[model samples]
Target: MLHATGSLLTIDVGDRSVTTTDIDDELAAFIGGRGVATKLAHDRIPFDADPLGADNRLYFASGPLQQSNMSFTGRMSLTGLSPLTDGLLSSNAGGYLSRNFVATGHSVVEIVGESDELLAIHVTDEGVEFEPVPELEDAGVPAVTDAMNDRHGLESEHLVTIGPAGERVVRFASVMTYDERAFGRGGLGAVMGAKSVKCISFDGDSAPALELPNEDLHMEVHREAATSDDIMRRQGTTNLTEFLNDEFSLPTRYYSELEFEGAADIGGNAVEEKKYEKAACSVCAFACKLPTRDEETGLETEGPEFETVFSFGSNCGVDDVVDVMKSNELCDRYGMDTISCGVTVAAYLAANDEFGNAELVHDLVEQIAFREGDGDLLAEGVARIHDELGVENWAIKGLEHAAHDGRVVQGQGLSYAVANRGGDHMYSTTMIPEYHGKIDPEGTAGKAEHVIRNENLNALRDSGIICQFGVGRAVEDDRFERLFDADFQDLLSVGSRVVELERHFNNQRGFDGEDDWVPYDLPDLESSLQEYYDERGWNDDGTVPADRVDAIAGSD
Candidate 1:
């Protein structure tokens, strides 16, 4: 019955045979949710697997703590090889859809083969079925969500649907799982589109039995995070703009300059002052989700988080919060990855002289959504845009323009450059330790050591499916281990260390230590890696010391 953990369901439309199995001991420890799914994808799919081909597998996984009283726990991961990065891609979303795993009594859904017809996979506590989604074709998330509610006759049922962005197979397209919180990032949505799977809906009244070390201890941990100065009590990550723009002065604009004078206009206080509503995920108490209603677009949506605000607001030279909100809504509706989508649009605008024309911008967005004209080129992503448009001024790796100066961030920048998925911020945000405040923001000295540490820590977080916000304070210290019990600690540490080995895995795929080098265009790009390697105790190559690798591998 798949009671304690979730079930893994594999459906082959080509063979018309469905196999369902319980998430077992080996799979649970291998990658947990996100990490484990990546392991499976790497093993199952060939390096030459066409991202949108029938041979690829679309992975959807729910964590163990999903439906419990755990805070901010409604997260599901969709992982596959991305056509954008042409490497591993894993995106996560938060909404009621995660709760459905607990209700429907399953952990992961693995679907294979191409369906000639449009279909939505529906799962209930009773069982699973694939139904045609004629009404949801080319529809955005909100519209599809409404249609699902009407069909199921239950508002509680969560819907994971993609918009035209996904259906069009935009290289940076995302799957909008929850209405607002997306399985966003990477080209996971486009992978689903290639399979002709429109969406997946499920709901049920069920909760798994949680295995807690101690009831009192568990509640105590929650109390600290819920009331801590870092997460709930502070202004939240929304306040990051003020620190980056005003204090650190590291906000990037079209990859030309860092520092935005107009940042104050869109600061966290501005959001709270101008907007009066807030939203949160399924069981989360800390709703950092700031929903603003724009008069121009006549739409209301959650977030414009620090990344979105920076990428779309200041980075693109648009200062109005309302304008940023509209852009945010448009990206969400189109099922586009906000980070990549915004950066790709900005790249085009910066490259094309016609970008100044308001009409051209409108046409570009429309065409990209509908897959016509220059939108075809624009939908491919910044790297592709650089190749097609011959603009080398700026490009992205994980989905973001190189932030904090690609060189100054050291191997962190290396990870960004060669990340299997593309330019990403969260994959390696070691800026905290590597960057000394008020110093040369462009300096790359002593960054490799910090990058390795933070990357491992972040890997642990993703594998554990915990929010970075809750662990922000502990990110630089050992307190990070306090969040989990002893039993899970061994797996977390091993998994964290394994991330680098996987980086080596990419190295075996033709990328190298030289590939870790930042583009020489940035001011400090040349010296960053050398200085970073020196500080990290590496002998020139960015590889970790074998002794340390063995020590970590032998842990627990």
Candidate 2:
């Protein structure tokens, strides 16, 4: 795979067609890889089309720094309307897929339509194919991964597939990539299910020649990763649990309480003690994926990352780390979102007073995994659960049933409500600024700016298809701009413009100030909207300033 030819390819699963587009040096220089992909996705899909219909498109795009020697840069973004939140959703994952996708001379793979039958798209240097995968019809994530690895030879192919959760259209189902990595938010897996796409198996032998702006800049970011305060390389991401639990007491159980007694038991240290081997993403220097077996269940699991740890451990009142790992493994195998599954399960317990009925809850878990009985109700998310159970105060009360409790992380609460995807954390992560004291998560005043900025920047990052951890690991502020060939500020300004464009796109879909506030359940929750707005020069409403929107969306 030579840089002289366009390595990026797009495949239309609906029509079984392949197309390759040249990467304009200008767009290539500014947006880089993932950013460009976001622009393309926004431009391609019709605004009013059903997200799950054949008209919707899923763009799995890689970034310019993907195959390069940047630390934790091997990531790709899955962009589309999330079936979970019903809003713009994009989540990144680390694995060999991004590297393979790019190495094969393809930057993007576009999937379209609700396929009439069960199928998997195999992308290779020889082109692409929509092949049958009836053998894995009801298999779970782990089984599906093993079957694909066995059939394709694990070392040669990279795969992304949906487990039974996706097959059953769980609203929060995630799209699992590689073996352990996942685009694990906003029900993108359900979108894949709606399209009848069982899996994506990618193979390529063409090696990419990824050179940075200057080898010096690449070396600098690489060196920083090795010695800097970045947590992934220094302590692995599992350490985030310690930070979140110790700093904010953020592990809410079924939206009722903020603290968990077992936080330390599920921390990074616990993972090291229990897991077997550690692995890294493609081209990544840090080996953070802790592949381990639970001492009690003897179940081999990949991670109990901060999100998973909180989502299943503290959030579900399941204190035992081994139980959390087993539960995590179960969710992944079943192709369900750990956060939503755990939260939904917790909500169910709270709703039915079954929080005390371990046997009933266990049966429900199995049912949800298989989409049977009450499992069907659980599959729709907390909102639906609240409706079905008819318990207003006991369930996840937001639109998509993402994280619990709108009262605690007010910024997150606003994001859950306004996000087109039901309830989600990633669509716009305001936690970073709030946690840093740059904005107030407890006040709703400046939230509009906080939410919009994070959403835009994260969208660009997600679109790059690189791991979100990479943004913290390699690229941050002006330092990250060095990864691109363009000037640092210029590259970021381009990202700002892309952000505004996304806002405009959302506006077309009827997103407004009303969609920018916290859910009704959180009577005390507020955000830094006022302060954030003052800083960004916006009105109290959080709408993009007319001048700002004009500057970004100029008369084109």
Candidate 3:
């Protein structure tokens, strides 16, 4: 409430209209970022709306902390009905966009309606403009970005654009920002494509004024981050590759084998070896981004992060980190989620026994973007095309599984099954505790409690618009109290409400206990899963209770 502008912007591309409304009560009740976005999507979007139709709205929002100079606050949240999963999902992207978005004088921006022509919508303090650019049809991310820069002097930081993948409505297309950073899950870019909105630019001088309670904490965190020697700052998230492989959960050769003998070839050390310079988003320190280049091969990309490494490297049987790096770049340019795109390629390899064919992997990345030939079938994603391809379904609710195999980390498998976002590891992050041996990774009992707490805590972090690495991860419970000027539990309550609201929305769409499923096995799966629902005070099924929904929406 302190940082919120208490306003929402709605842009209807179909009619070329821009409107604003006061959301004072909603902001107070839901907080900002994911929380506010979820509430808005719940109440406004029709329960049976098609994920890629005009009825499905995209909400882009930043949270209270974005008003401060906090080290981990340089991220934004995008909430929408997922084309891949057919459920509500909130995806986070870290870049310079959050700062520019906050300057627009609105807590959230919603894009609605469909346009007859591909248009770029520009938002500023003064007003809005919809410019039709038919010539830019089928362009990739860089082309759209370069056009925006040349025509409007807007940089990648000021633009959120789609690529050929989105233009073709690839089921796992991604909404890309800062050229490379992505709202990588759930096909929101395809939603944009469906709406005929190719890009949106933000720059304004109407940022709301806010008072910081623990202003010094920002500097303290930044100073610590500047002096820290965290391995993530060197290799990005690839630091988890070898460990996951060692634990027999790396999902090599398309989930057939749990371990990758060549894990070290594409693990953190390999990524770090290609590092040419440091990179960070637009704010304070804690530069944990990997900007790598292979000078001999002339391949440069930000990262083939842990998930990317899993999907394109080990999962596809490719040992060369640079090959994964090229896949990473290809996905970014084409605006596809690397996890989904890589798995699509791997799924093909499974059918053809062509594992480790790096050239085919790269070619598949392009074909998926263009929706050509086999790419057209693979573009449909693993879940939808598995029967035709004659392979084991490796997807949950249509979203491809990430690197952390659920079988090895039993808790994570449970987390993946009941997750609202389907196969998204971040939904609960049970892997964190499992990885640290805080609990038995193989045990099923009592794991639900950890999943519950982590789901809420992560929801809170997304609302804070914070990263989950470096000092962001180290920021403790008490530190959060001073920063938000609110009780830690109270902040977590906001998260609980967000989670409940997501479940409520999905329930309205007919998802229940049956929909929360994983492909592989887990011990006591039904019992532990039911226990999770019981602890949440929901029915025996996974749907949120009617009373709880009212409470989450603040109607009670």
Candidate 4:
């Protein structure tokens, strides 16, 4: 195993004890990050454990590429039972954290049990320390990062933290790192908050010596990133805003409409006008992160990315881009997933007929973080409270939908129905091909195979700890096999195993083919789903067979 540290670190927050064990088998078999983390979670997390309970564990892990510090390798993976979906889930974030994490010399770290008081855990090559942090209870993300830097001399890159939203156990709360980057989709932060954990910081210098297939490959990719004139570098992800809105679906007014009249005001060009600086992750030269500021109002933040444009801008009928930026800042400051928080707020606007009330939208973000007034119900996420609000439930499996309008992008619609993470665009990522005209976007007849391959490939990418934006750029073609020290098909197989592990784990906890669903209808959905199951060799009920489950069980 090229990047194997040959060890695992298990932390029991309750007892403040640490155990390190050999996990070379897992490292080699799963290829670390999402794959290894999923393998561990499938075996260890109790099937019936509450998502926010002490029994639920969160796994933070790294992959081989971290050692290279390559252009797209500055990311890491995390897996756990989801507070939002009540099923197993995994998320990854890109930042300066992965290199620091790999420095601790453990490829995988498992956080389990709960603490009686709010706490922070520090992991280093020397050892682990649990510090009771009662004074930091319910602190916001900025406050925690400042205290960690001021009191402990730990920088933003060294900390993984949750804000007031997580401590309040908001189902859509996010786990943040590098100050702004997030393990964002699932409510992993709520799980941390449920454990009474405030933050965990990493620092060390005992990184393993990685064997690269081609030493110059990273620099080659870095040069490509540095010189590329990708439009995303100019506007970040919001570059897709006006285009998706004009040609496809932007999910206006809580998905009641598909077009926004004011999209130009909040689209990529608008965001570009506010961008004052450039930012990148770790050694990555892509520098695609949006660092925007409104000098007139003295407001600044990282991004109101394309999704935020949909969620807070068009979805809630607010067209002013600055309002969306403020909403983005609040979500980051309070440690919440922007997609879930924005969509939940959009749902609120729909139910109350308050669309376009930007002030109310900002209030909702803070309210959800603090669980105040109507924010409490909204904090439960759209799936849990849509009925009481007398509005259409736009979520699937408790997760609110992203900006990609599945009704227009049919393959993505199919992906949303069956994704383990539920309605998340990145889970299968059919949107890219659909946007590029690579796949027919009007039907699901022959889309199952493509969806399966994409899911598997993304699974491997998460394990690789590679940024998704770098897919076609830094790590495509035969380069993927070379970097991972494996064949193309074999890597896909590893990804398939990871996906099956998650599905099987969630299956045991009462999800099945029935749970593989979408809110809106799609053409030939039934046959496509059958094709998907048949391709994977799963049971008709959408459950992984015992033999396949056993094949991935344990490190052995």
Best by TM-score: 4
TM-score, cand. 4: 0.99
Model 4 poorest 10 in a row by lDDT: 1-10
Cα lDDT tens digits, model 4, 1-556, are 3445547999999888899988888888888899999989998999999998889999999988888857888898989999898888998887789888989988888999989999999999999998889999888888899999998899989989999999999998999998888899989999999999899999999986667767677788888998999998889899998889889988999999999999999999999999999998899989998888999998988888888888889999999999999999988888999999999999999999999999999988988999999999999999899999989988888889998988999999999988999989998899889999998789888998989999999999898778898987668958887777677898888889999999999999989899888888899999999999999999898888989888777436
lDDT string, candidate 3, 1-556, tens digits: 2445547999988888888988877777777889889989999999999988888999999888888877877899999999898999999999899888888888899999999999999998778899998888888898998999999999999999999899889999999999999999989899999998889999987888767787898888878777778777777899988977886578988899999999999999999999999899878477888898999999888898899999999999999999999999999999999998898799999999999999999988998999997999998899999999999999998889988778888899998998898888888888878888888889677788888888988898888767887323657888888777888888888888888899999999999999888998788999998999998888898888898787666641
Q: How far is candidate 2 from the true structure (C-alpha RMSD, Å)?
A: 4.1
Q: Per-residue alpha-carbon lDDT of model 1 for 213-254, expressed as tens digits?
A: 334533654666466555333334567777667555444556
TM-score of each: 0.86, 0.85, 0.98, 0.99
Every candidate's CA RMSD: 4.3, 4.1, 1.3, 1.1
- Clashing residue pairs for model 1: 6-107, 7-107, 31-36, 397-422, 397-423, 398-422, 398-423, 398-424, 399-423, 408-444
In model 4, the runs with Cα more than 4 Å from the true position are 1-3
lDDT, candidates in the order shown? 0.63, 0.65, 0.88, 0.89
Q: Which stretches of candidate 3 lie over 4 Å from their true place?
A: 1-3, 470-472
Query: Which 10 consecutive positions of candidate 2 have the poorest summed lDDT?
Result: 393-402
Query: Between 1 and 2, whose lDDT is larger?
Result: 2
Clash count of each predicted structure:
10, 32, 0, 0
